[model samples]
Target: MANLQLKAIKKSYDNVNVIHGIDLEIKDGEFVVFVGPSGCGKSTLLRMIAGLEEITQGHLLVDGVDMTHQPATERGIAMVFQSYALYPNMTVRGNLSYPLEVSKRPKAEIKQRVELTAQKLHLNELLDRMPRALSGGQRQRVAIGRAIIREPRIFLFDEPLSNLDAELRLEMRIEIAKLHESLGNTMIYVTHDQLEAMTLADRMVVLRQGVIEQVGAPLALYHNPDNMFVAGFIGSPRINFMAADVVATTVGQVQLRIEELAIDSLIMTVQQRLNEGEKVWLGVRPEHFVSADGADCHFSSTLTFAEHLGHTNYLYVDYDQEKTLVIEQRELEKHTNGDSVTFGINAQQSLLFAQSGERIR
Candidate 1:
């Protein structure tokens, strides 16, 4: 079993602290992804798990054993770095065989393990090829094979596909996902790319300034965000926000006056009670808008720009106080610049957030 438990994890540099007390749990054979903006300490936390970074304070328990200050080699963990760290002078077989041979495994055992790993990664044909002769994808596979050959209980990936082009990244994503399925080892991957986090993770840990903002399955965090930062950060086009006020209240609903909308008061159904004239922020996704004639809240805007992405269109419009609004269009007529058009948003789909950025469900 490879279950990991982090107790009040903390890290610092020269007395300047980062990685605020972080507590997390990882079950055996689970795939967890750590994602956040740059400098958020996802990589630092992963390194701590690998025993590469010293923990300032906290207990790192793996399978109920404290391995916090253990040396990396004895931690039963293998890491795949952003750069494919292959030995330039070594062939693929040499790289995969080195780890087992160093552990004093029998020669026959090393050869068997190397051949099996090569077959699993489809690198058998290139086993004799040097790193210099391999493409970006091939080199990365060899790197992963090197880690797999050790049969470690845990795998750590730190932005492993960031250097590859978009197409290569997609291909590698599939390859890594397949590898995880075949291995069933505890895997912790870190990346700033939301798409990667969304697609690859069984659970996602969203962090900010070294503190975890939220953790859950990708869609759970997407549809039911705990705060504004998560709602804005999780989506591709990003969610929209407008300053609003509670004008009145009724049974199971509240009337809101959004400054950006010309409409008087739009009814929003909610489970929480609001004081009359209380200020709040309302948000909706880009694709939540409808034609003005069909919507309760309508707002006119000058079309600043539009993009046609073959199957869909992205509309950027200039709205109140120099704020820009993005509307996603699919199965709708194409729009162009300078067009004065009105759009509508559904009250039920709208999200309310307190001034402090907490979600008000």
Candidate 2:
């Protein structure tokens, strides 16, 4: 296991910058995920760390050694790509031992490494099968086994589950999580899927448009996002945002006007620097919006749509002013598509963002 550190890293193509300066310190044996939308530079940053892309500036260190100028093989890193990248004609054993063979390890050592990796990845039974004979998930496991046979100090995965079906993806995700637990090596995963990142990562780095938006544990980022972007991007069904005006500000409370509903004087214990009459954004997660009353913030709206999701339901409501809000409900009562509903939110659970899309507190 090795700690990886990137300091002021930057990447450019023909003088046009794609990845801005980024600094991150990944602890040894930690699993960190880079998550963002497509074209957001998550993959570019991962490739740079893998030595597949040139570092325009700054330092890349692995285990306290500078490796910015090193070749991919010399960096002691292994990568599993989204495409599987397995040789079509090669058997599973051949594929797993290819890297070791290239490194000129003894034949007996290569065989032992391949056998161990195959066993660890649950591919021992399929060792002699060709890539075409394996299922998508099996092929992916073989790809991972190939990386494991290399005995790399760090493992890098670039959207490795994107090509699998939903059920297969879930199964592979569990397997990967278990593999990380068993290996306990430094692993960096890059993906656009928020749920995958939330479930698999020890900590996550959120990026947007070549810039770092926020970095935190999954629950921490979900509960306390730095801005509207991070809050909206990190959650399933996304957090609901509403335009509101600050009606009053006191020492420990602030009044807000949401469309026609007024949150009459809510207490905010956190010290927030905000001026009077500022237009701020109010964010409420779907699960945080409740059906009961007695909340600091309450509103009544018409249900535009309701999706019955077996265990729970998602209610999409529209205010009189035409702003839409999503609410997640458990033990949901049957309601028509356009039924009127009232939702409540605890002020402490609500988030306030400034006019510039930054979280106010």
Candidate 3:
């Protein structure tokens, strides 16, 4: 296991700066995930850490040793890429033993390690099969097994499950989680899928446009984002945002009027004071909507669409002329499309953001 430190890490192409100065510390045996949309530079940063790309500036320290200029093989790290990257002609046993063979290990040691790694990955029965003869999930397992055979101090997964089917992805997710639990190595995962990050990471580093937006536990970032970008990116079904104008301000609360929802006045607690007429955004997650009788603030809208999952239903209604607001519901009531539905949210469960996209506490 190893702890990693990144100090003012940056990357640029010609005069175009991609990664801004970033400083972070990853604890030993911690499962950290870098999550962001495409073009956000998550992969670039991961490659930099893997010694595949040169650091434009800044330092990378591993286990208290500066390794910014070290070669990939000497970094004691193994990576599982998006593609399986297995040799077509090699059997699983060959694939697993190739690294040891290249390192000139004793034949007996290579045999023992290959069997052990195959057993660990549940690939024993498929050891004699070629990559072309394996399923997608099996191939991925082989890829992981290859990495495991190296007994690396650190593991890097670059969207390793993106190539599998949904069911396979879920299965592989559990497998990876179990592997981490048993191995307890420092692992860094890169993915654009927020749900994957939420499930797998001990902490998530949310990035946007090559800069970090937030870094914290999954639920922490979900419920207590520092900015609108983090708030908007970390949740599924998306959060609802409504435009409002501050109507009044009290000691630790502000009263607002939401014209889009036709709300006359709603009071919400805040840590910051706002001007009487300052524009702010009201943020509410889908699941925060409540029954009308239990609501602090309510509005009515015609249901434009409804998605019925097994345990929950998502209701969508048109808002702000072009935007749609999604409300999560778990009741047994059935409402057809175009039916008027009343949606309510407690003031205490709502969040307030400034027009500049910063959360107002």
Best by TM-score: 3
- Provide backbone clash counts, one per model: 0, 0, 0
Once fitted onto the true fold, the runs of candidate 1 whose alpha carbons sit more than 4 angstroms away are: none
lDDT of 3 at 192: 81
Off by over 4 Å in 2: 260-267, 320-322
Cα lDDT of model 2 by residue, 130-244, tens digit:
9999999999999999888888999999999999999999999999999999999999999888879999999999999888999989999999999999999999899988777
Cα lDDT tens digits for candidate 1, 1-361: 3999999999999888888999999999999999988999999999999999999998999999999988999889999999989999988999999999889999999999999999999999999999999999999999999999999999999999998999999999999999989889999999988889999999999999999999999999998999999999899899988888888998788888876656557888877778888888888888888877778678888899998898888898886767988889886577879998778887877788888899988
> Is candidate 1 or 2 superior in lDDT?
1
True lDDT of residue 8, candidate 2:
95
Candidate lDDT scores, in order, read: 0.91, 0.88, 0.93
Per-residue lDDT tens digits for candidate 3, residues 232-298, read 9989988989899999999998899999889967889888879999999999999999988978889
CA RMSD, predictions in order: 1.3, 1.4, 0.8
Q: Pick the candidate with the highest lDDT.
A: 3
Q: Against the hidden true structure, what lDDT does model 3 obtain?
A: 0.93
Model 2 local distance difference test score: 0.88
For model 1, which pairs clash?
none
Candidate 3: clashing residue pairs, number: 0
